[model samples]
Target: MNRISLPALFITLVLTALMSATSVLSQDSPSRVLRAGAYAADITPTTFPVESSGSMTRRTADKAHDPLHARCLVIDNGETQIAIVTCDSCMIPREIYDAAKEAASRITGIPTQHILCSATHTHTAASATPTFQSPAAENYVGFLTEQITQSIVRAHSQLEPARIGWAIGNNPRQVFNRRWFLRPGVSINDPFDRGSDRVRMNPPANSRDLLQPAGPVDPEVPVLAVQAIDGRPIAVWANYSLHYVGGVPADSLSADYFGQFARQIADLIDAGETEPPFVAAMTNGTSGDINNINFFEGGGHQQPFEQIRIVAGDVAASAQSAYQRVRFETWVPIKMRETEIELGVRRPDKDEIARAQKLIEDAAPGPWSDRRLIYANETLDLAKYPAAVKVKLQAIRIGDLGIVSSPCETFVETGLAIKQLSPLKPTFTIELANGYNGYLPTPGQHALGGYETWRCKSSYLSVDAEPKLRQTLLALLGEVAR
Candidate 1:
């Protein structure tokens, strides 16, 4: 050392310092186990224009703005962090979500992949994407993004050393399948009817089509209970497969059934029966075909109050069962990964585009080509230009639990396939997470014509879909293990 050259000494010192800094940074990160904090803001508008139905006051739920609807959770080991933001509305555009992710990454030193932005898919909720048909919905996008981002930033500052545990229970009874292949003879005339079609087709979706359990169901309701060091619960993340929110009415701002579900958990925890001060939110699972407001059922898509209570009971029971099933909770390694896959698009031919343009300018605009409509306009543009097939996929493995988000409503059969190869003891698959891609059928389903079964609409994409999703999940698991 005494005889070392100046150049050699400088190089050795730089290498030593780099190694020391790397070790300290790694220790501060949540690569292995971490603590989390959560916060949500009620974004219901203070005032809004609306109408109502029998006994249902539009003003009861409708307000000045759409609910900012945020779920901010932190993934951290004290020093480093990442936060997840989910809203109750239509899909958040990938670009918008990415921007928020970038902002969070800059502050927390966590990669964009670690920041998740998901949606609750409430039809009553306003669209958060730009270009809304109604000014109200467009205003919602701006309002929601600001509030959600603020919530994420707030949640990080509120992080407390907490414990997290998960459990699962049955939830199929709350929702039923709305699609069925009408058997021969049943028709609009027949009560217990099943009808036959020449295309050998199903009724598509009849208000009267009875539920025919066509595939495997993951009825388990998974719940993650997050508690403070004082044993007070901060939040309970719940997941279920049903898709009905009985509270939804025109212009209303309620979070629907999920809200009720959350309140139930809060009450239980507040009573000191479980964990106090807990926030419970139910995440929507593969519900592309599930409906809770069954017009097909006795509810007739109308409120009975009794119907709300009944469904609430079902949700509560499922959530309770999940609460009882926490096997273990030693902060396990977590790997959060995202990949862009194609959902497929419907690009019109040169002639089709020309015809559409003429129709839009001259004739009455088609529902799919309305210039003033946000969704329709996007559809129109997609027809003029083919949409890229880049859907985002996420994989998060917490200890032995693997949770994957397939933004598209994954087919039951396809979900079964993923589970078959999953390495985690339990793999929770959530769809419509970031944005919606309609119903994601198998690559084979594209050949079999049907509404959700087919990818004819511009929103219906099919590129880099199935295989990319699988690879993304596997690759993520590998990364987390590292």
Candidate 2:
């Protein structure tokens, strides 16, 4: 037996006791848990003969083929809480969105900044902007606010210990770049201008007739899966870039493929009455110049409701793959930050404004020659009001996933750039969030000249607005990540 010095023995005993105490403390402490809940509210118009927004032509829908909803998902990581609400509407105007968010914040105790609201951009949905002062449009705004607020509150009340997983899956076959580059001398003059555009929207589907696509398509379908602590799924939120998949009959209000896709996903996951109320949502992605029409194959010939089913099935499969790939985390950091900026509207020059006024004044009030001219008149009307518009940008960091949202119809390239520059590993962009300010095309695309770049109420932002919005969103992402 070796003899040990008294001081050495004492030191060794102290160290052992400290290690034992540390182990006991670590074992005694409770593990932090992630909590999540989902709720959806029916926001379909109650009154009949409602004007559904989309084209320059006014369309009234007395019936709804499918139910429209305001879906919400609430996530909490012990320290921070985030509420993501998506509405099936053409556009949620800033005023209405602000009111709804404020009410939700008060009811749920989540900060107004923490609530990120977005629109699914379904053209068949009721108009929420109230730009035309139509009775149905104006009344629907109040109804929409109440439904969304109730959704957030209900989600908050249902929060339970849960695990979250995020993944990105590719579905490149569905979405296509809508803007096309026509062959030389194939440019046609739009009603807004006598000048012909080198690049135009929805060119002939035949490849031999067109040069190529003017832009790129973002085929990424990002999914966030929420599951109970016992491994039961609660909800699946997926984002895609294709614009509305229109297959509805005339004068019919619907959520289009978004509502269909959610139902399909829920069924695929087997979320039924036996299990917890499982909610699924498909949020609109950066698709300012993207849509479901595969011009390369053919245009205007797609079978009506069949295409929606096909697209929904494909997206559901992609969601399943993504869910399988991600590793669910029970505890993770969650943070949310928002920023608001005012950007000047791109007003028409005096000459163009005068011409538009003259055209509207000279024509009879019955009907205009072309529908595009009506949009031109709307531009002049808007010019008489505000010179600038406020844009809301938000960023949320959940573990390794980063989500950035913009109120404008963002372009695919902008979304890609944000994802690439994000500090978080997997980033996704949500467009038409909080409010809708029209298409946000890059300056380079603006130079190419297309329907998206045309200066009208539909897309009224200044030329530099895209860059400004991009930089602001990036900065917000960095802040939240830190």
Candidate 3:
């Protein structure tokens, strides 16, 4: 009934058109909602007397001291999804991990590159890869592949609206640099008889000859936690630079401190029973040169598995302290990038091979009485490896937190350097991930010459491998951060 002016009509029409355009745009690209899911899939071998892979000599476990698991966590930001799995084993080969990832990708609609699988480096777990005298348990490998694949599938199926956060905790009392420099005149007693090593690995505790640690230990415990929209705990993923805590009884399969941490953290956070059970994973960080042993202060004797329990309790407490401070975010962008780089292998030459052959033929061999013989055999084995091998490296970004992974038992120095230089505010490294290349020692650490730098199946990467891998990882992190 009111008289409409020309200017009022024009303005009304313009406002209506603008509102319609905005509604169409909003409908086309809705706001992203973050969702997360987690599962702990049992990976314990069904058969007994399976070979264990972490020891220098062949060792078989007849029974399971504790169940092993493949802890899986899936995060989705509507536009992208990523799956991370940490298995309770010593180290898994690339072939097995590839098979698992391919199968998981097919079912979950996640790309193979979006999945990151790693080992917990538990010394007492079943063997899936041949290392030293232990041969790969074919049956267990097959079983493990299936289990890992299912872990991802089940985790994806459980996805629900969730909030996520991360924080860093410090626990320096547990980690120590195991490689040490001895006083003047003390022989290093290199297994290869090179007589070039200036430092010794795991020297006697409290020995007067001990001069100083050759490397530094990383004590930062980075934790990522996810919870339901209703404040129900979902999962906690924590990383530490200390290697496995080994005090398990012989002929028994255990997950070392890794499994203990999972159980204790659940209790510490009061993640009680739920329809979809809460999951926790403790992943191994850059710990090639770090261990629980404190050579400066000698440790007293303890019962079997006692050391593992003590270490797990202390670390879980540290994680809980950090978990309490996390500020949950309802939505965060997720990004992951993977790349492969070729690295030269420290293969033995003709002269080295001939010497190794001679040593094997001359030695009275019934289980290799001397450590030199073990290394002599390693030289011959290394000669058959390819001159160059490709190693996979990955970087992941969740909000302001960054995680980079290497397929090696990486040194703490490399992790520290990555954290310091990464564009993301807080960054951490996961070692022995995706595949098993070998131990990664920086050029400076390699110069000092310890067990980790010895040329063998366990430590065969070229001298420059660490620098190349570190740079590549930093570049990937930069890409994801952008």
Winning model by lDDT = 3
Backbone Cα, N, C clashes tallied per candidate: 18, 0, 0
lDDT of each: 0.58, 0.85, 0.94
For model 3, name the residue pairs that clash: none
Instruction: Between candidates 2 and 3, name the one with more favorable lDDT.
Output: 3
Displacement of the residue 106 alpha carbon in candidate 3, Å = 0.5
**Model 2: residues with Cα > 4 Å off, grouped in runs:** 1-31, 130-136, 299-303, 366-369
List the candidates ranked by TM-score, beginning with the highest.
3, 2, 1
* Residue 191 displacement (Å), model 2: 2.1
lDDT of candidate 1 over 1-482, digit per residue (tens): 36998999999999999999999988775354457777776655434542221121112235422233677777675434555666665455666666666776676566777777777665555544422232224444556666666667767767666766777667666665544544445542211111222112223344344434343455667776776766667777777776555454454555666666666767755623442234566777766656664334444444633454567667877787677666445354555766765544655456645654555566454333332232334335657445555677777766666777877666555665666677775676776666655566555544433334422331355543666666676666556545
lDDT of 3 by residue, 1-482 (tens): 89999999999999999999999988997468999999999999999888888888888999999999999999999888999999999999999999999999999999999999999999999999988878898889999999999999999999999999999999999999999999999998887778999999999999999999998999999999999999999999999998899999879999999999999999999996765999999999999999999899899999999999999999999999999999999999899999999999999888888888988999887367577888889898899899999989899999999999999999999999999999998999998899999899999999999899999999998999999999999999999999
Residue 386 of model 3 has an lDDT of 95
How far off is residue 304 in model 3, in Å? Answer: 0.6
Worst 10 residues of 1 by lDDT: 190-199
| 359 Cα displacement, candidate 2 (Å) | 0.8
Q: State every prediction's TM-score relative to the real structure.
A: 0.75, 0.92, 0.98
lDDT of 3 at 319: 100
